[model samples]
Every structure is written in structure tokens, then in C-alpha cells.
Target: MAYEIMFASFTFFSIMRYLITRFTIPDAVQHKWRWYNVWISWIHALCAGLGCIYCVSIEPTLLNNLQDYDIRFAYNLIEMSTGYFWYDAIDVGVLSGSSLKESLILLCHHFVVILCFTVVVVTGDHVPIAIVCLLVEINSIFLHARQIFRMAKIYDGPFYTVNKIFNIITFFMFRFVSLSWMLRRVILDRSELSIGYFILLVTSFPLMIVINFGLFLQVLAKDVPAFTVLQKLQGSKNQNRKEKDACETLNGHMNGTHQTKPVMKAEVVSKLE
Candidate 1:
């Protein structure tokens, strides 16, 4: 049922994007096939965000037991989001015209996520998985918004800055807090999970954390700082231009006074003679 819903949603969104973008969205057309990949990401992020919210609202204590939980529609929805990633990994990896390194990193991330989610779903130990999804997917909405704004050439605007701020805050809140919670569970909570399952969980979860942390640093140290410097440079240019204009105006006034005084002095001398 989860697979069916996800596959159907994926197919529906793909065709809908084709029709809508072909006829309606000039921006999508302008981006060529890359826009379709972005649409896939956008839809997945929306589903994941909503699914996480619904899961937490209904079962606030779901994360209390990492290894035991009942499987619900919320889990299915979260599982369905993995299908989008799978589809996108193949789609963008094959057709998105991105660089090989870029494609490989994206595919690697998607593959790891799909594997982790599959293990949790199949083993019916879904509580920690739900927590992971809640942490990871909620912030994706803002991340995709930043991408969309960049594609639309509005990335330097106020709205994009707001979205970036939200992205940073949510990333820190969800990723750091959730990882810390999961680490505590691993150390303190004993579960009947298979050795293989435990190993996979332990390895994959932290690997993702490391990758995400590196990306966060890139955003903090590289992207955000570049924008700040650019704004400062622009401000400096404007200030210099204002100072130049003021000096030019003062010089003009001084020249006018000098010229008029000379003319007045000539006239007074002629009258005296």
C-alpha cells in the first residue's frame, strides 16, 4: 500500500509537472529539465513535512521507545517520501544534466536514506525512524524554498534571506537535537533489534549526521558569508559615491564665489578710477 501510494503520487506529479510547465510555467521551461527535478524535490519535501507534523501531533510519545512502535499511516507517509527520493535519484542522476560529482553525492544520500528507511519499515521498528524522518524532512521544506528562490533569481532578496534563516534554524534544531536524542537511545536503551540491524542503524545514522554537518558548515562559512560581504561592498560603493557628489557640489560653490568676487572687484576698481 505504501509503495502503491508513493508510486502513484510520483507518477501523478511527474505528468502534472510536464503538462503544467510545458503550457503554463515559463520559468520551468527556461530551466529545461532541471526544473522537473526541483519539482520532485519540492513535492517530496511537502509530503515529508506534513507527514512528520501529523505523526508528532497524533503520537507525541512515539520517539520514547526507539525499537518498539506500531506502524501507522504516518509511517507509511514517511516511507512514501523515500520513494520520491528513489525516483529522483534515478531521474536526476540520469537526466538532470548535473556534474558527475554532484549526481553521485545526491544519489549516495538518497540511497543511504532509502536503505535506512527500508530496514526500519521492514523490521517494524519504526519509532526511531519516525523521529529521524521528523528531524530530517521538516527542514527540507525551507531548503527547497531556497533552491526555488535561487532558480527564480530572487535568492538575494528579502524573502530568500528569510527562508535561508529559517532553513538554518530548523537545520540546527532538528538535526542536532534529534541526533543527540538518538545517540542517547543507542547508549542507554536496550532493544531486541538484530545485530545486523543495529549495526546498519548505528553506521548510517551518524554518517548522515556527518554529511549534514559538513553541508551546514558550507552554508555558514561559505554561502552566507559571501552574501554578507557582497552587501557590505555594495554599501561601501554607495557611500563613496555620495561622498564624491558632496565634494563636487562644494567645489562648484567655491568656484562660483571666487568668479563672482573677481567680477565685483573689477567693477569697484573701474568706478573708483
Candidate 2:
């Protein structure tokens, strides 16, 4: 059943990728590849997010017995996500033009997730914990939608702002609050957990916290007024530096010194443009 679900998930994502590429024209040529990727991601987030909710709704007891409870449907959902991560890791790392840095970060994340999920599927233990971790996907739906909106050039306006609001709210609720609660539970239940589960939780939770916190900061910098003010100040500083360099270059040209090096534009400017 796990194998069947994994295969079905891989095939479904593959079809989504093909259909998106064949039918949709990206708003910008540069967004062509990311456009396909983000749409597929949005679909996966929706499925996994809602699937987690339904699984928990039907099996609320799983939360009470996190160690030993097993739900076939929950395992199927984990398998489904495992398959999607495998597909996305391949798509981002090998098939897409993602930079080495971006690819490595995502690949590392996928590798950890696949490893953890594979253990649960193989051992048939910790299914409930897996589902709890997957609740973060609920936040990811908004995260991916934000990317979709950006790629489609829908930045300003009520809809985009509303999505951003939801993104921040969900990030706090699902990603931050849920993980913190899970971490507390894990520490409290350490004696009951197996050595393997203990090690996995100890290692994976910290890594996840680091990654999620980084993402949270990025979201805040983009959406929060305080961070936006800091960003504007940083931009102003970069602009002043550029102007200073230009003036120095002009002075060198006028004096026939030929010593002033050309100023390289700030990388932030290139990314924004």
C-alpha cells in the first residue's frame, strides 16, 4: 500500500508538471522554470495540508498515543509526501536551473524528511508524530502561494496583501507554535520513546527549528514594517556607496590617474531587478 501510494503521488506530480509546462506561459521568461515548480508545490501543499487535518480529525486519539498508534491512512499520507519530496529534490537539484546554494539547502531538507518518513514507514512506528510534523505543510500552502503571486507579478493590491497576512499568521500558528509544542512533548516523553526515535527527534527538530526560523525571518523582512524599514535603510546605504564609487571613478578619469577600480553593483540590486 505504501509503495502504491508513493508511486501514485510521483505520477500525479509528474502529470502536474507536464500539464503546467505545456499549458501555461509564465509572466516572465526567467520565471518559466520556477513557475512550474511553484504551481506543483502549491498543489502538494494543499493536498498534504488538508490530508493531515482530515487524518487527525478522524484519529484524534493518535495524538494521545503518539508512540504506538498506527493509521493506514496516515502512513499513506506520509508515503505520498515522501514521494513528492523525492520528485521535488530531483526536479530542483538536477532538472531545474536552481543555483548550487539553493539546490543544496532544499536537497538537505528533502533528505532529512525522506529519511525520517522512511523510518516511520518501515518500522510502522511514530506515525502520529510524523503527522504532527506534517502539519507545517498547512503553512506551506500560503508560502508557495506567495511565491506564485510573486512569479505572476501580483505584488501590490488587496489580494496579495491578504495572502501575505495569511502567510504570516499560518507561519506562526502551524510552523512556529506547533513545532514548539511538539518539541516540549518530545522532551517530556523522552523516557518512553525508543533510542532511535529519540535520536531522530533530537537531531531533526533542531535542524527544522533553524530552517524554519530562517524562513520566518525572511517572511518578516518582506512583510513586517520594522524589517522593511531596516531593508530600506540598507538599500539607501548601498545606493550611497554606489554613488561614492562612481564619483571616485569620475575623479580618476578627470585626473588621468587610471587607478580607481570600477564599482560592482550590489547583488541585492541585481536580485530585485
Candidate number with greatest TM-score: 2
Global fold similarity of model 1 (TM-score)? 0.73
Q: Compose the digit string of candidate 2's lDDT tens values, residues 80-148.
A: 998999899889998897788868878888888988888887888888888988999999999999988
Question: How many times do residue backbones clash in model 2?
Answer: 0
True-vs-predicted CA distance for residue 260, candidate 2, Å: 29
lDDT of 1 at 139: 84
Can you write out model 1's per-residue Cα lDDT over 1-273, one digit (the tens) per residue? 667766776676667566746644445346757666676677777777777777777777777766655647766765676566667776878777778787777778788777877776565575555555556777888877776776666647688888889899988877777876776676565465667766776786677788888878766754488766877799999999999967876787878643467558978999999
TM-score of every model versus the real structure? 0.73, 0.81
Where is model 2 more than 4 Å wrong at Cα?
230-273
lDDT of each: 0.70, 0.85
**C-alpha lDDT of residue 267 in model 1:** 86
